[model samples]
Target: MNELLSSAIKALGEKFGGQVSEFRDEVTLLIPPDKVTAAATVLRDEFTFDMLSAETAVDYCPQTNPRFHMVYIFYSTTLKVYLTFRAHVNGDDPKIATMETVYPSANWREREIWDLFGIRFEGHSDMRRLLMPPNWEGHPLRKDYPLGYEEVQYSFNFDEIDVRKPKGVR
Candidate 1:
């Protein structure tokens, strides 16, 4: 597994100038957002990574360069190995070319990332909210978002609760 991963990383770095870094069994390649589609094509064609297992994102609002990162997990059925490709984009304008062309399953995954992390997938067939409501204000998964709670209406008397009621008392 490590041998195949190293070979794949070497090919990607040589072909697309990807910043290949490995941590344990996971090999991450930091590719440019604009080159994402092309890079994915190479991975699929040359590396035999035909299955796209998942597409997700991480919001690093305070990062040095690109504050937003999109992660694509792919599996090579022939090689029986896993590879993860990551592309970085500015959080102010988080955008990356969609890989839906190469992997049809990326459609919904990309939508989920956009809905939760505000990472925009350009050229996606159906870029819509996958989880959050259409009228939702902000991306909840973003790290910059406040970790606060909304006030809830209590149906029971709070004064009576001071009597040490059971936890599940309704």
Candidate 2:
């Protein structure tokens, strides 16, 4: 609702046909996956959203239309305003263009998303695991990723829990 944000939104809407959603005074521009880099470039170069504050993804599994939503947060020091961009990625093969070229700080954030969500970033300089081990089999953060849960033992259910728990070699 601020003057700068209003102008930015109008400029973006005119340049790129993206859907704008506002909640709690925060604006989110929903752009296509392929236009992420372009939109980010415009935001940084034209609107002065110079800093890429954070980049992350959310998994909405079972909703194949857009299984994941890639979220990017930007901040402008001069204007002291924040803007967010969200791009929906298909579930079949979740992938999107990298914004590293536009925002250098996005390099590691992209890598982290790749490592945790199995979402690939096309044109990434180094597309490798940022947090998980290189040998790690699957993305642990995915909604479909299997979790290893241990049975809880209590005074009354100790025997029942022990029967379900995995045994270790003595």
Candidate 3:
């Protein structure tokens, strides 16, 4: 890690008592859902991580205790480095504090996560679907969501499957 990120990690550990882990040289601070907003605030106000580069969610289906991991990436223009942190949310009713207040750009990213992953963002100014229709039934990105995959047709089954597929004339 570079000097800036190293020092930022140290400061974060001291502030939040977060669990730090590394993957491919990238450091991630695993924080509880409750402290996520506070951590983001500190990262912005104190660490000079002025940009909320990205905010997204990951669903761990079939595991309920900590079902979702909300990932936030921050970039510091002054320091020229990136830092990532994640908040663990319960699967039963996954919810996390919003960072849009700290980083205005987070508004859309948070909405996307809420729309596709079914993760709620508390204190979000306007939480609504970004890509999906307003009345869409369920979050399509979740692992538990139906695949809706169709089988491919081969030469042997071409004639049989072709009859079921809609035909078009050009």
Off by over 4 Å in 2: 167-170
Rank candidates by TM-score, best first: 2, 3, 1
Model 3 scores a C-alpha lDDT of 0.87
Among all candidates shown, the one with the greatest TM-score? 2
Model 2: per-residue Cα lDDT over 96-120, one tens digit each: 9998899888899999999999999
Worst 10 residues of 1 by lDDT: 158-167
Which segments of candidate 3 are over 4 A away from where they belong? 158-170
Q: For each candidate, give its TM-score against the true structure.
A: 0.82, 0.91, 0.88
The TM-score of predicted model 1 comes to 0.82
| lDDT (10s digit) by residue, model 1, range 107-165 | 89989988988877888989899998899988888887887663343558555554554
Could you tell me how far off, in angstroms, the CA of residue 85 lies in candidate 1 after the best superposition?
0.9
Q: Candidate 2: lDDT of 107? A: 92
Models, CA RMSD each:
5.2, 1.7, 2.6
**Superior by TM-score: candidate 1 or candidate 3:** 3
The true-versus-predicted C-alpha distance at residue 46 of model 2, in Å, is: 1.0
